[model samples]
Every structure is written in C-alpha cells, then in structure tokens.
Target: MGSGTPSFLGLLCALLTLRPGSGFYLPGLAPVSFCPAGSSSSDCQVNIQLFVNRLDSIESVLPYEYDFFDFCKDDQEKRPSENLGQVLFGERIETSPYKFSFMKTETCAKVCTKSYDVSKQEERTKLEFLKKGMQLNYQHHWIVDNMPVTWCYTVEDNQKYCNPGFPIGCYVDGNGHPKDACVINVSFNEKNTFYVFNHVDITITYHSGEGEGWTGARLVARLYLLGVLKKVPFQYLWDYILVSMPHTNIQWFSIMNSLVIVLFLSGMVAMIMLRTLHKDIARYNQVDQEEAQEESGWKQVHGDVFRPPRNGMVLSVFLGQGAQIFIMTFITLFLACLGFLSPANRGALMTCAVVLWVLLGTPAGYVSARMYKTFGGEKWKTNVLLTALLCPGIIFADFFVMNLILWVEGSSAAIPFGTLVAVLALWFGISVPLTFVGAYFGFKKQAIEHPVRTNQIPRQIPEQSFFTKPLPGIIMGGILPFGCIFIQLFFILNSIWSHQMYYMFGFLFLVFIILVITCSEATVLLCYFHLCAEDYHWWWRSFLTSSFTAFYLLVYAVHYFFSKLQIIGAASTILYFGYTMIMVLIFFLFTGTIGFFACFWFVSKIYSVVKVD
Candidate 1:
C-alpha cells in the first residue's frame, strides 16, 4: 500500500499538469490587474469581490463527481499560454480581499479616443463612448444560478468589447491600443449570506472582427464559484453604465408560439384519453353478446391475440439500446441538477454522458440478449453484435457528417478528430464486446411462454376508423409527452446555439418523469382498446404509438430552425437534421420501448385472467 501511494501521487500530478482547467478555480478570466498590500494609491487598488451561491446538483439520480472533464482532452497541443490574468484567490490563499484595476497604457488611450468622436457626432446613439484619456474597456455579467444573462458588444482599441448593461462602464482611454485599466465592482445582497470566502472563477473573452458597420470589437466576462460559500460577507463598489439596444419582442413571440402549439396538442390528447376514449371503451364492452358479435373491428382477431410478435430479436436489441438511453438521460440530468455540468464546464456534460453510456453497454447487451432468447431467437451472436453496433453506428455516422460540416464552417461546436476517435474506440472496443458477453448469457435462458396459446390460423383485421388507425393514434399519442417538454426544449436549444447557460435540471427531471408516465399510459390505453376489438397486431402499433413523438420533434426542430434561429445555408440545415436524427432515433427507442412493455404487461394480465373457449 505504501509503495503504491507514490505511484498514485505521480499519476495525479501528471493528470493535473495535463488538464489545468478540470479542477476547481475561481470563476472568470485571470485578471490583468493585481493589488499588492500597502498600495496607497486607490487607482491601483479598486476592490473587486464576487459572490456565487445556490450550488445544487442539477441531476437527482447520479453521484456528484467533479471529474466531469474526462471526455475533453483528446488533442493536446501546448500553445503559448496567454496571461488571462492574475488569480486573486488561488489554492494557496484561503481567505483574502483582492483589488484589481487595469493599468493606463498609450495604446488604451488611442483606442478610447477614436470612439469618443463617433459618440460625439451621434448623441442619440447610446454606445460606450471612450474619451482620449480612457484606458480600458470593462464589462461584467451577473447571472442568478441557472438564468440567462444577456449581453451585447462593440469594437474599440482594435479589440471587440461588451458591457453587462447599458452605458458601458468600460471604455478605451488615452492609450493608442487597449490596456487592462477598467475596474469592475461586485458585492452580494443581504440575503446572499450563504456563500463567503469561496473562490469563484471568472472569464473575460475579447473578440475583434469587421462585419456589419464600423469595425467590431467586443469583450465579455463570465463568473462562477468553485465551491459552496455558505454565509460569507463581501462588499465592493459597482459602476453602472447604460446603453441603447433593440427590444427582443420577436424572440419572445416565437417562444410563445411554440408553447401554444404544444399546449393545443396536449389538450386534444388529454380530451381523447380522459373522456371520449374512456367512455367509448366502457360502453362498447357493456353491450350484449349479440350486439357485440355484430359489431366487428379489432375484436375479430381475438383468437391470435397472444401470438408472439415477429422479429423479437431486433425488438429486443432496440429495447437494450433504449435502456441505455434512458439511463444516460436520467444520470445526465441528475448531475446537471447538482451543478457539476454547469455552463462553466463547457462540453463536460456531453463528455460525461458519452463515457457513462459506453461504460453501461453491459446492461444493454444483457437485456437485449435475454429478451432475444425469451423470444426463441437462434442468432444470439448476431443479435448481440447488432444490438451493440447497429443503432450507435447510425448515430455516430450522422454525428460525424455534422462534425465535418461544422469543421468546414469553422463552427465552435465541432468535436475534434481525437475526440471522434475516442468515441469510436468506446463503442467498438468496450461497448460492443460487453454486448456480446451479455448475449451469451441471454441465449442460455428459456424462451418466455405466454399464458394464452397462439392460434394456428391468422385472424382477419377489420377496417379501422380514421381515429382508430395506427397513424392517427400514434401521432396523437405523442402530443401529451411532447407538451411536457417543448417548453424546456426551448431553453436547451438556446443554451446549445445561442451560447447561453442551462442549469435547470430539476425542472427537466420532472418533465422527463411526466413524459414517461404519459407515454406509458397513452400506449397501454390504446393497446387495451385495440385488444378488446380483437386485434392481435398490437405489437408494432404499440411501439409506433409512443415513438411517433420523434416525428413531432423533427417537425418542431425544422420550425425552430426556420423561425427562431439565424443560422443559414444548406450545410447548416443538413447538420441540424443530422444531429436531430440522432436525438429522434434515441427518443424513438425510449418511448417505443416504454409503450411496448406497458402494452405487453396489459395484454398478459387481461389474457391470463380471462375465460377462454
């Protein structure tokens, strides 16, 4: 044990050296200014303090592991480490009051002076004006846990800049270029006593570009806490700046429109299930034998109702994959709730989920192989391998295509080549082998025997009414679950595309639970009706019922792209659908499996308890 300790420590050191950003650190970019003790001049020591609280796990089901950066370190290139700034509250100092202010430089003055002329000519414009004497551009953002903090930017000092609010507190001063002279003040309200002395990380990004209008430059700052700060005291001064901006009524309207559509679909499904369908089922079943015999539809196929579904091996494979998806989703959301996958962790959530899913392939294979055996499937090896590779391969291929497009477009969202290779290794090396092992065990088990025997002759299905048909019912079944999520999906999309933070896993988990219950109940209810009508073909229909939500999701994604997003071009559109297909495919499996099992149980119960001729 003692000998191993040194080796473990060596490994830890190496890991830390390799991944500096993975560990806890104060929020925001390193500061350009630092105040030494005994500095008499206030210009050199503007006190800056930050308070971050409300730390809770976004996920309700997973353990808290700060090791969320496991998937991000694929391509390791050592670039010149630019000084982000000085760390006021590093691991070395536990308790410290820090002051940070930008220094006056010639370049800073020149950048600010040029902006002053533009502001003077346009008095009506509320841009961040810099005088010939200003030196630094300062911007700050205050985010309340999971909420969005909106910002805008400008160009000055040959740099891109942004302010937290209007009338930018940051400006270019007398310097010919940009300098770190701006000071930002921060403090906590009286109610924010729970967090103190805890280090919060902050990042400030600068961008320079020339697009629409006068050369564009912008600087933006983000802040986050490293640990929980319960009941701590801190104070600092804040400079309030104002600026003119366009109202975002259109954006809000688009969100509202999506909500309305979701609500309308939900209401229709609810009405059909709760009142009309329920009453119809009871009334139809209460009819006398002669009348019931005369009435024919799904009831004609009653004798073959217990016949085993075809292609059970494929279905089992799907279920296995669905189980993996379900678990992955559950754990991801649970961790997000805990703040481990907070916006500050960029790509950490995806990395964590993929890693978890890969590790979980054993269960997927085990479940699929067991089910295939129960269905009397002979090709255990093929079933297991396909279960492991087929669906995941499709998704990965689609994702790779999208990544290629992103790479071409120089989009920030593209996954790197090394990460892609890591993904492949995870799928083929770990998940696939585990799946085969699971299938081996599953093939050894006995086939499941139905309580009611299947008839030799096929039962003829009667013509279904428009509402009773599979297409309409399946389409209708998805509306309720989608309603529960469409509102949440809006925020998720915003986070993914608009570069906003999403930390509301609590609400998301609830919605997920609601969706599960809704899908199960809707599928079971529909299956029961068709069964009573004597239809034995409920197998595929049941699966399709809940899986239909994927179509709705695809439709909504298209609508969102067209109306809500500013993205352009054929490649962007193709990339969007390529990714959307992965999401839809996963959803199809999850909901379809839920419906299948629920209906399966319902059919088994009804048939086992009924009196048969």
Candidate 2:
C-alpha cells in the first residue's frame, strides 16, 4: 500500500496502535503537525509517518497484505496490534516508506524503483501478479492522523465525492479495451500492458488551531496526483480515482413510499381492533340462553385453540433464537444510528455486533424456556440445550465452511486458529452458562397463564377455501412487509457488494420500525380471517406467515446476483450465496418471532374478553 488515510477504518487502526503522536500532544486523538526537513524548532516541525493497510479488490473476496503484491515495503516494517474486529475484517496494517513534514512541498522525489526481468520465471510471475492486481482493481488503503486518505473529485452537478482508497494501476487488453483508469491518460493505450500509478503528489489540508486552545491541529487531508510522475516512467503506485455519489432523491422517495404503505397498514389494523373486534365481542357476549351459538365459528373451538402445536419443542427453540437475533439487530442499528458505529469509527460495527450477540444469551434462553413451559413440555434439559446450541450451531457450521474456502485460497480474510478458538470459548464458556441461568429462572417462574383452557380431546375443523388455506394466507402475508423494505434492500446489498459507504442509519432505523409494524399487522390480519373460518391450528402457521418474507429476500438476492452485479468466478458465487443464506436464516427467525408473538397476544385478548363457556 501507499501513503494516505482510510477514513474510519484508519481511525480504528490508530486507536489500536496509539503510537504516532510522540510529541507533547492531547492524548491519543490529537493531530501532530509536520514541517520541511531543515526546519528549526521554532517552525514547530513534526515528523509524519504514514501507515498502509490491506490491499483489496472488489471483484474478489480475498485481500492480501501490502507487501504481498511486491510493492515498496518499509525498510523497518512495524506492524501494530490488531483487535478481533480488525483481524476478522482482514485489515493488515503496517508502516509505509512515505514520510512527510507539515508544509513540506514534495515534487518528483524518487521512491524505490521496482523492476522485473521478463526472462526470469520468478520475476515474470511477480509481474503477472501485479497485472492481475491492476486488472481486478486492487486498492491501497492508507491512513494519516486517523483519517482516510481521500481522493476527492467533482462529479455530476459539480458535487464532489471522496474515495478512501486508490488503485494500484490500470490495464488494457490486446483488443485495446481499457478500464476506467486507463482512459484517463493517453500513454496507457498499449495493448496487453499494465500501466502502474508509480508517481503520486499528495496534498494534505488541516484545520488551523490558531484561535483554538489546543496546540495540535485536526487534519482534513486529501491526495491528488496531477504533475508528479516517476523519473523512470514505468514504476509508480496509488493515486487518482473517482466514482459518482448515490442520488439522495431516490433514497428519500423510497423511504416516503414505505411510510405511505405503513400508514395504510396501521389504519387497517386500527379499524379491525376498534370497529370489527369491538362489535364482534359485544355481540357474542350478548347472546342469550335461548339463542343457540353458532358451532362453526372461532368461539366453538376455544377449547382446542390453545392446544400445543406439533413439534412444540422445536417451535420454542426457534422462538428463543429469534429473540436473540431480534435483540442483536435492534441494538446494533440503534448504536449505528447514534453515530457510535459511523464511518469515522471504522470496524466498530462488526466489533459491536459480535460482542452483543455473545452477551444476549439470557434473553434467548428465557424466551425459549417460557414458551416451552407454556406448551406443557416436561423436557426442560432438551429445551435449554436446543435454545443454546441449535441455531448457533447452524451459523457456526456455515461460517466454518466459508472460512475453509478462504483458507484454501490463502486469503487474508481467513480467521486465525487462535481467534476461532476464542470465539468458541466465548460461546460455550460464557453464552451457554448464561442461557442455562436464564432457563432456570424461566422454569422457576410459573408457566404463562392462557386466557382459554385446552380441551382433553381436540375438535375437528371444517374445510378451508383457496383464499383461506394456510399456504395461500402465509404466502400473501409476506407481500406487504417485503414491499416496505425491498428498495432499501437494494441499497444495502449495493453497499456490501460494491464497497460503498453506508452511513444512512437514521433512515435505516425508521425503515426498521416500519418493517416491524408491517409484519405484525399483516400477520394479525391474516390470523383473524383464518379464525373466522374456524381454523384453530394457528400456532405454526402464524410464524410461517411473516417468515416467508425471508424467502422473498432470498429470491431477491438471487435476482440481484444475476441482474445488478457482474460478479464472476465460482468462489465469489459460493461466498455470496453462503453469506446470503446466513442473513436469510437470521431474518427468518426475526420476522417469524415477531408474527407469532403478535398473533399469540391477539388470540389471547379476544378469547379472554369473550364469554367462553
């Protein structure tokens, strides 16, 4: 990698290393000044050191160390300690050869020139690797004073967008087809040749501490290479690049569109609760001794409606896991919205998520044990074990398979054996015990009291129409909820695959709230209509209704892979789907749990208020 900043990711690296500001400064967060090499002490000169991170290509999931690609490595290679999140994300940070002093004007000063003799097989291989890096658009991430080294340029409407990393080089095929970087310069037009960005001129800007009380200044640095080139033309590195910014109008319109649907769904639910249910209850209660009740409706099956569903144990386990996922997602989003996980904080997002999930075992076990007890289950041991192990096991297995692929490819993204062991220790040593403690308390507390009692013998129900069949209703139930989030989903997937900045947490949190409301209302509405048709087997069906939204999500992911992205290679395809499956599973649990609880509450409230003889 080269000399520059990595925005938030760099901030995280700085937080860990905490070494640079050797001068008398404001703890670890201050910006140290720089000056020309011959400056006196009165000039307040600061010696600046630039740090380089991992080199990554968007077309490939694998990232490599800066030194791996035969770039100019530091004479004294000093690697800083990495945190769990940094390690997991494959951020390999090390000192770079580029040095600067504040206000030091650097022109065509030569860096180490690299050469490869094509006749030597080893050198040919190295050259080929460098070309491959350019072909796939590998980037060098550099950090300066805890800020990303941004390359800012004007786009449509004269708006400027800054990119965090710069490319290694540019290439053109034998047919004269060129990448975007190749078209910028005429000298790079040769066929089947790699044009390296060897020479760079970086500009660093900083806010003055003139009026401020602080002696050190906060840096606002940018790098632009216009007039600087290598004395030997062929050997150079990281510099100029640009990409257009996402339009705000479309994103806002999407949010507004989702809001309108949510308003409509909310009105429908309000009408059902305030008007239809109110009249239904009053009318049913007023039925006298002489007038016989209809044996074909919901009231006739109150006894069997409360019966435990098939695979009660499995249902409880799912509920428990869903609870954990729901809590994890909510808290993570809330933290992001509050700027704790902003682009300035780097890998705080992943670090926060992993830590929270490990600590949330209590809620999972508690919800599972309570539900199982309410189902009149006697096997508490099995219930607790399933709650703690089942879903987590599936996730770990999937993760392990993906990690194996990374390992086989020798990607830096591979988790070290030590980190993997640490994760397992956290799971079994901490989370499992916490889950058991929650389950014990859950069991000690009395089982939830149902409003209606279960009958010794289950009652037979009548046939359902095409409209009211469980499959049709469940299928229909997911449409509205999916509609509310599909547009947002597009942006989210784009961020992941394209490596774009995603700091739109406020809108995201709002959409999250809307999604939850839409899921609940849709499930409740469907449950109500089914009960009117005398279907008392509402337990598992209610959960499946909202959970099917995740299926739509999976379908959309497949469509996105084909339509929106140009991702090639079997490894990339496998990695994409593997991660997508994990997301889908978590979403299934989260949405399904939401629908089930809402339906359960609705069923209990209706049966409890009406006169059930």
Best by lDDT: 2
Give per-residue CA lDDT, model 1, range 315-390, as digits (tens). 8889889888888888988887776765444345676787788887877887888777766678877888789888
TM-score, candidate 2, is 0.88
Runs of candidate 2 with Cα error greater than 4 angstroms are: 1-45, 151-163, 226-244, 289-292
In terms of lDDT, the poorest run of 10 residues in model 1 is: 8-17
What is the clash count for each candidate, in the order shown? Answer: 72, 15
User: Residue-wise lDDT of candidate 2 within 1-613, one digit each (tens)?
Assistant: 1111111011000111111211222222334443345643553446667788887766776778888788877788898777777877777789988776665455555557676666778877777777778888887777765555644555568676655567777777878787756665666667776666665655555555556654444344344443322221111111222123454666788789988988898899899899988987888788863442553467777888889999999999999989888898899999888767765565777888888888999999999999999999999999999999999999999989989988887777788999999999989998999899889888888988988888898887788899899999999999989998998898788767765556678788888998898899999999998988888999999999999999999999999988887676788789889989999999999999999999999999899997866
Cα-based RMSD of candidate 2: 6.6
Give per-residue lDDT, candidate 1, residue 170: 23
